[model samples]
Target: MKLTVVGGGSTYTPELVDGFARLRDTLPIEELVLVDPAADRLELVGGLARRIFARQGHTGRIVTTSDLDAGVDGADAVLLQLRVGGQAAREKDETWPLECGCIGQETTGAGGLAKALRTVPVVLDIAERVRRANPRAWIIDFTNPVGIVTRALLRAGHRAVGLCNVAIGFQRKFAALLDTAPAEVHLAHVGLNHLTWETGVRLGGPDGADVLPALLAEHGEAIAADVRLPRPLLESLGVVPSYYLRYYYAHDEVVRELRTKPSRAAEVAAMERELLAMYGDPALDEKPALLAKRGGAFYSEAAVDLAAALLGGGGSPYQVVNTLNRGTLPFLPDDAVIEVQAAVGPDGPVPLPVPALDPLFSGLIANVTAYEDLALDAALRGGRDRVFRALLAHPLIGQYAYADALTDRLVAHNREHLAWA
Candidate 1:
């Protein structure tokens, strides 16, 4: 099979290359293309990718290019991981929102909305190109604001599925805690992308008995620590919230903390410099250890599994993915994209039925879903009022003053990215 990775210049590419090398038997790729506009960074990352593949004795040919059309032409799948504005823009996204006393994050608040507006149009253009190149090629989006981007792709009628490593990361961590194989542990993953909860942890498969309570009872403190949430909250809710939830659950505290520390974008920029330097070393044939600190844990495994399943290659029948709800959560609109455990195959992800949700989680999910709708609106059809309305809809920035201030800041920081501005 052939696969194309747009934004393959990202520091995260090595981790993905390592996974492709290690899991070669699972996917059996014959041609791999890395597409990026930044030629210098592409050369560094592409060299490392080739070495990683060769070091593992994999026969797949690795190619690099700046042409999206040539990279995606006739490929079995195209993976989107591009950051529209790079780390400098991300620094703005991470800093400006904090001025409004809202948590500064890339995928969760006004900052996330800014990123959505900048990213959706670029991704749509790329998807259209991919579709023209190979109508059968599946588009797997790993970009930030995945739900919004995936929704944009689906609404445009592209053959696409969104991929996130959060579920797989949780699966691996939970398996280690339970002393079981990763495949034997299944998560009742729910809610929207980046805003999800592990409602249940089942063993064997989706049909297996739920063991979430047992895991929580024994390891509540550890689990809470991992996500930086209070142990008491987990005990009370009977579910584990993703780390991103910390921004919502402790908004003021997170804002205070963010104000004191350097932006995550700054730290990642430094890390990328070091990673690129490492990639330049001819002797470095494998993924460096520092790459782990760069994040996207278990992304390679998730990508390989999803791609294999989508392309008729043999793999698990069920996996967690971001796809349309289609009534999986009775509370969400049918078109709302959600991350949940679903059966995977050549036909794509079919979301499984979720058990009845407690009002606590369901209410938040519904609220965020509404905000996402407004955010997508602002992304597709740009205007100051639309931007202000989307910010006002967000639970974290519901106050009018903050929304007004954030809307202005978002536009000012991202004017170059927003064509209508």
Candidate 2:
């Protein structure tokens, strides 16, 4: 199979390459293309990718190019990891929102809306080109604000599925804590991308017994600490929440903490420079340990498995993915993209049956889904009012004062990206 990575210049590429190199049997790639306009980073990442493959004794031909159409042409799958405006824009996304006394995050809140506006247009153009190049190719999106991006892709009639490392990372974490293999721990992972909760931790398979309560009783404090939430909160909710939920469950505390620290974007930018320098070394072949601190933990494994399953290679039957709700959650519209366990195949993911949800989680999911609906509107058809309305609708910035201020800042910081501005 020929697989192309559109944002292969990213520092995250090496980790993905490492996964592809390590799991060749799972997604036996014959031709791997790295497509990015940033020629320098692409060259560095591409060279390292080849070395990783050769080091592992894999014979896949690695190609790098700046041409999107040329790179995606005739490819079976394309992975979108592009970051519009790069880390500098992300720095703005993470910092400016904090000025409004909101948590500064790249994938949620006002910043997330800004990213969605900037990203959706670029991704749509790429998807259009990919469709023209190879109509049958599947698009696996690993972009931030994945639900919005995936929604945009599906709405545009692209063959796509959103991928996130959160579920796989949680699976691995829960497995280690439970003294079992990652595949043995099945998370009742639900909700929208980055807004999900592990309602149940089942074992064996989807039909396996739910061990969530027992796991909580045994390792509740550890899991809560790992997620940076209070142990009592987990006990009360009886489900493990995504770490991103901290921006909601502990908004003010998170805002205060965020204000005191250098933005994560800044740290990642510095780390990228260092990593690129390391990538320039001809002798370095394996993915560096520093990449672990760069985030997207287990991204490689998840990508391989998802790609494998989607392409009819080989993967676990029921894995967590972001796809259309299709009535999995009665509260959500069928078109709403939700993250949950599904049986994936060449036809794409078909979500497994999800039991009725508690209103506590369902209410938040519904609220965020509405915000995402508006966010996508603002993304696809730009307007200041629409942006402000989306921000106002967000639970994080429901107050008019913050929403108005955030809308102005978002537009100002991202004027170059927003054609309407």
Candidate 3:
């Protein structure tokens, strides 16, 4: 089995690799390929994954390369984890939104729009390459702005699935809060990609609804207090929510704070510099002890684990991922790709169904449509006006006329950076 990891130099590469290494018995891997433009980091990770595989007595060929064609050729599955550009570009993605006086966050609102604009073309380009090279290969995408990127590939007509650890990770957290086994707790999720609510969680069978109301009522305050956001969402729906709770649950407060404070873009950039300083060069004289403190498990564990499962068809129910708006959210438009609970096999992914969404949750689902519509429109038309309309139409931004003005300023200031046509 050939598994190709596109963004093999990513900070998360180690975790993903470890995930496969630990699950070797479940899904034996035959060959692992790490592909990244940066040869130095690729070498480091390639050596590391090989060492781990050897330690586990797995006989898989590990190859690292900068060549896209070489990396993807004859591969059964390709895990795309590219950042398009990396953290430096992410700073610009965030900063551009703030300059326009809109809430300057990385994954949503104007920032997400900017990212979609820059990322869609690159993702589509890669997908097309893979399609031409290997017509039946499954593209397992792990990039951020996952929904946007996945939809771009799907619309462009490719075999792709979006994956995220956030939903599964948070589900475990909610299980702990409910004092139940993670597998015992069944869930139904809705909305777009990272931004979504767990519309339902049940303790056992189809009758899982019985446990939801009490679970939410009991943990409501704790969940809200933990994130410092009014997380009435899951509670209102009688379930638990996850992923960027601090932002969505209290969008009002977060929005207000962004308005009152100086843009944190520079501060965030500085922080990124510090992180890169610590990790960018392993040979640097003073590697942060904290860096060493990070276990090898996080290094190459998760990606490898997923790779093994996808390749070997591990029978165990891993929270493998797929992107489709069809089943998990029948209420939403069919093309809206959402990261939801998926059962993976040698064939591909089988998505579980999304439960009925509440009116507010349903509205949030519709809100995301505006963004996707504009993004798909931009990609098809090669223009930014649709993106501008997308920004103004976002439920959060459209609520304020001032936000609209700020968006205008943001586009103008970052016109060159946005590379808008």
TM-score for each candidate, following the candidate numbering = 0.99, 0.99, 0.83
Candidate number of the best lDDT: 2
Model 2: lDDT of residue 189: 95
Task: Give the per-residue lDDT digits (tens) of candidate 3, residues 1-421.
Answer: 7888898865455556655666666656688889999887677666666666666677878889999998899888888877655665666656555554456676677777766766777777788888888998888777767887888788777878776665565556678998887667766654567666665666663356656566568777776564455556555546555546456556667767876665455554454345444444544322233433332223233344455456655543445364666646666677777766666565556676555667766777677776677766765565545755777777657745645665565565445545554
Residue range 1-421, candidate 1, lDDT tens digits: 8999999999999999999999999999999999999999999999999999989999999999999999999999999999999999899989998887887899999889999999999999999999999999999999989999999999899988998999999999999999999999989999999989999999999889999999999999999999999999999988999999999888888999999999999999999999999999999999999999999999999999999999999777899999999989988889999999899899889999998999988899999999999999999999999999999999999999999999999999899999999
Quickly count the clashes in candidate 3.
Answer: 20
Mark the 10 consecutive residues where model 2 has the least summed lDDT. 313-322
Among residues 3 or more apart in sequence or in different chains, the pairs in candidate 1 whose N, CA or C atoms overlap within 3 Å are: none
* Each model's lDDT: 0.93, 0.95, 0.65
lDDT of 1: 0.93
What CA RMSD would you report for each candidate? 0.7, 0.7, 4.2
Off by over 4 Å in 1: none
Better of 2 and 3 by TM-score: 2
Task: Name the runs in model 2 displaced over 4 angstroms.
Answer: none
Candidate 2 collision pairs: none
How far is 186's C-alpha from truth in model 1 (Å)?
A: 0.6
- How far out, in Å, is residue 95 in model 2? 0.9
